[model samples]
Target: MAYHADIIVDENGKTKCGLCKVFIKDSDIYIEDHLKDTEHSDMYLQRLMIQNNIVINGKKISCLLCNQVSDVAEVLHHIDSSSHKGKMSSVKKIIEKDGGLLVLPEDITTVGSKVNCLVCDGWVEFNQEAVKTHIESAKHRRARAIVVQPLNAIFSVEGSSEDLWCKICQVYFENYIEVIFEHVDEDPIHLKNIGKLNLLIKDQNIDIEKYLHDPKEDKALCKRCGIEVPCNIDNLDRHIRGKQHLKNKK
Candidate 1:
């Protein structure tokens, strides 16, 4: 596993190196001293590769939990570890499969802009070129089909709004809000009509700020633009569809 290195300041104002997990008095030469430490340098490079999602030579995959690169055989063992599976299950509920696409629920705690592939459960590079390469991959296409087939089945089932089955929860919602917000965020098929959720929120006299402030309410952050959207799914989709988030990815 890759080591975590964060520069921390102690109560006495000493700088603590994350990887070394030790304190040194803050001084003009602190940075220089740390860089010269062999242990620090090795840990720093491993952390850098983790941050950039780079696999070292001969590595086949990176673990989703710790960002540790591993070979094909070792990767399987790492993924099966208790710690790894626990982390994977936490976000698995928020991942949905669409046609050749895996949609993730918006995460408020993410440090910076990122795009993650739910199928491989890995982070894809943020640039256009890297995103393009991932979308064209055969593995991604197969996983997407596994999710799309079932979603499309229930999507068109004829029933009363209350009787409609939620693909995520696999049960009927008591109201439209439950359908729009609760299940939609976890189901890719429901995301296609997110505008309906917005309008319902407005009609119910809810505010975007209220939603953001309250964890219980649906978030207003757009999955594509990372901005607030209008009250209708059609309008929201129109705004995001042409943008980089929904770009000719299919």
Candidate 2:
């Protein structure tokens, strides 16, 4: 599939993370911080699992939520405990009814320039097409309606409540993000794009600049290099402390 020029494919075919453009990877310092943290780290790992079909040796891969080493297969199940599921359900209802999409904490949603729907925990660039597609998604559409079928409250809607009997009818989910994340992380088709993006960025491809720049947003851009910093705060700190910045000071 032809993607934006920011993605570069190599002979060896091992894809890089920066190419995904879901997260930024301009600075090595930022990359390091990304590897350590939870949110982006989860996104990265999930992308890999879904895109690459990676069979994670869970013993080796630290749990994204708790930082504990768990069996790879059980990791998602472990993280999607009852409390987490309840919170997600509650947040979904709140987003649908109140329209205040604060399902996740402020820090998690505010990291990037894109408008993120915390209900789906997904993001897209700030454009009409992107926003339209996102809002129209099945997940978003399902989230738009807040309905709970009581055990005794029977209606004409045949399968509105009994998801237990029919898996396909299951609308209310528990840790849907975690499941999707794992699947996407293992998908090779997606990984190929990520790999491509990483190569182009590393080679200083100008085409990828669109993903990096957001003129209207101030916090999204870097204060030091005057360039966009896509990664987290630790990376920005490291960038400020780097030899390049140090030399400029002298």
Candidate 3:
């Protein structure tokens, strides 16, 4: 076979196709047979498109899977990179399961320049780079695992309900949405467990008078240390074991 730039004939007489990452028998007949395979033909067309810069600007090529941009000279390396291959595999799985990729996943929403992640209750830039960065972030992954995944499984198993559950606190609340919101908002233990609450509560929806009259009362005052700590099991344990509190005890 006439060796192209992408096809290499090693010293061992093995013919390798860089794009397909396959080794064909050293004979010209075997090489030609492999190149005629439908899969290899598709890959060859892709290589041509990349070489001609039909996917993006002439200087750079944008990956169809992950939207990563690379110089024309480095396009092959980018395509073979772990990140790009992983994204391609993931998208292929989604397409196989869903029958198509026309619809965005439920957790993601794009609005102009902003992309909202329902799982994390946060917005990122709409570009693929920013969206990918946000999806791979620790906070977003944690939220998806702890909140979205569990909720989805529960809903699928038991059917949807208005009841609220806090996985961090391991507590389930009745359908009183406002009460659940207040429970999560005022409970220092819940706040500590979640680090920060991502739920958005409007000022008008909050009962200001109720909070004013019924302020948080479960607080432990350490007279020796002159500090007040939340009256939760974890907070009390931390406070008693703290160096300042130990020094004050002496």
Index of the highest-TM-score prediction: 1
TM-score of each: 0.29, 0.19, 0.25
* Candidate 3 residue lDDT tens string, 38-119: 8876666554443322355688876654656788777667756788667656643533332221223221122322435666
RMSD of 1: 15.0
Candidate 2 matches the true fold with a TM-score of 0.19
lDDT (10s digit) by residue, model 1, range 1-250: 3322356777777788756678766774875677577888665655543433334466476654455667755644665578666654543433322233543323223333355776777766533445556765777655653444343223323555444444323455453433433454465545554345545444332345534233233334553345555534455446545555455233
Cα lDDT listed for each candidate: 0.49, 0.41, 0.51
Error of 2 at 68 (Å): 11
Residue 225's lDDT within candidate 3 is 75
Model 2 alpha-carbon drift over 4 Å, by segment: 1-19, 22-74, 101-250
Tell how far residue 127 is off in model 2, in angstroms: 29
**Which pairs clash inside model 3?**
none
Measured on C-alpha atoms, candidate 2 has an lDDT of: 0.41
* Model 1 per-residue lDDT at 50: 47
